[model samples]
Target: GSRGSRGSRGSRGSRGSRGSRGSRGSRGSRRSVGHVGRVCQAGPTPSAKASSRASSRVDRGLSQ
Candidate 1:
């Protein structure tokens, strides 16, 4: 009946919950980036130099 069709729309609410989880995941990634930036700043190893440049690019991107 019409009620059965209406029930399908309830599934859309689950998508909204997933959106919040995605935001939390973004926050986690930003924290990891910050940690990497600190390590790059503290000790400039060969690999850290590359990470430093990448982090600089990220900063510029954020600024622009």
Candidate 2:
């Protein structure tokens, strides 16, 4: 009987807390941070770069 009581208490303690304890008990089940997905930072395609470079040459004198 004592072991059963203790086992139930232990299960209750860990059942819904998600690891955090005491004062943070209320929000313990909540996830604080999550990542959506990876981000790609590859530069513009070759054609895009060529067009930008061409335009830059045409505007080089005006930028000064």
Candidate 3:
């Protein structure tokens, strides 16, 4: 099946003519780091998560 990949840009790279999915839910290192409860670039680390969630909700056209 043709889909997204989850590996990195290594020297050898992936093989076998197959790859992993690239969905956000499948990313092991996924961390919502952005403007959540505060300014994404300037807010404290704590507020960043909140700001990011807020942003994602808005991005998805969902009411926050």
Point to the candidate with the largest TM-score: 1
The residue-by-residue lDDT of candidate 1 on 1-64, one tens digit each, is: 6877666545544443445445544664577567767787766366545754565555445433
Error of 3 at 6 (Å): 19
Q: How many backbone clashes does candidate 2 have?
A: 0
Query: How close is every model to the real structure, measured as TM-score?
Result: 0.31, 0.27, 0.29
Collision count for each candidate, in order:
0, 0, 7
Clashing pairs in 1: none
Runs of candidate 1 with Cα error greater than 4 angstroms are 1-44
- Residue-level lDDT of model 3, residues 1-64, one tens digit each, is 1233334223113321112222332342245433233355564665545654654444344311
Give the true-structure RMSD of model 2. Answer: 25.3
TM-score for candidate 3? 0.29
Q: Rank the candidates by TM-score, best first.
A: 1, 3, 2
- Decide which is better by TM-score, 1 or 2: 1
Candidate 1 TM-score to native: 0.31
